[model samples]
Target: GQQVMQIPQYQHVQEGEDFTTYCNSSTTLSNIQWYKQRPGGHPVFLIQLVKSGEVKKQKRLTFQFGEAKKNSSLHITATQTTDVGTYFCAGSTGGFKTIFGAGTRLFVKA
Candidate 1:
């Protein structure tokens, strides 16, 4: 069985600050996905990384996959109240099921 784990289960930052969350897996993964769940909302897919050491970005957000395919990270630059939510990293070991990490909750203050 494979498992995905995220660090700093929670993060709190003032507006305009930066935040980051790390994810690790128990086994090598074929692909890794990132999702964001806004308060009172469902998880929404943000991005997916399949290549070793892959990196992607969307405006102020950045994502990375480890070369070993067993780890990942997400970083948000310039925090805003609208960015408050839970971020989750999911990994698939070339299987039908994708294991998700305990989401990292982000709290932003003005």
Candidate 2:
């Protein structure tokens, strides 16, 4: 069995402040996918990190995959009210099996 874990189960940041969430897996992953689910909205795919030690960014957001392929992180450079959401990390071991982390709920205060 495999498991994906995420932390800082909840985060609260003032507008313009930075925030981050981390994810870890019990076993090495083939790829890791990040998603954000807004209030009352379904999870929307953000990005996928497939290479070890890979890093990607989308505007104010940055994503990273561990060198071991067993950890990942998502960082927001500046918090905004619209950034409030539950961020989830899904680690795929190969084939069709993917384990999702519990998710980190982010609250951006204005």
Candidate 3:
């Protein structure tokens, strides 16, 4: 059986602060996908990594994949009110069933 886990189900930060979220899978994954969803909005794909030790960055945000393909992390620097949303990580175990980690919801205060 495969399972996905995430930390700090919720986070609150003031503007100009920083935030980080982590994701872990119980089994080795073939690929890891990160997504973000704004309030009342659908999940939007952010990035996906298939190779070991892959890292990607978008502006003030950084994403990383574990060497074992069973974990990942997302870090955001200089948070803003517009950065308020829920982040989710999904892992695929070389099959159709993709498991999503418990999302980490972020609240940014102005």
Give the top-scoring candidate (lDDT).
2
TM-score for all models, in order of appearance: 0.98, 0.98, 0.96
lDDT of 2 at 98: 79
lDDT of 1 by residue, 15-98 (tens): 999999999999999999999999899999999999999999999999999999999999999998999999999999987899
Worst 10 residues of 1 by lDDT: 1-10
Q: For each candidate, what is the lDDT?
A: 0.95, 0.96, 0.94
Regions more than 4 Å wrong, model 3: none
What is the lDDT, from 0 to 100, of the residue 88 in candidate 2?
Answer: 99
Q: Residue 63 of candidate 2: its Cα lDDT?
A: 99
**For model 1, which pairs clash?**
none
* TM-score result, candidate 1: 0.98
Instruction: Compose the digit string of candidate 3's lDDT tens values, residues 49-97.
Output: 8999999999999999999998999999999998999999999988888
Instruction: Provide C-alpha RMSD values for all models, in order.
Output: 0.6, 0.6, 0.8
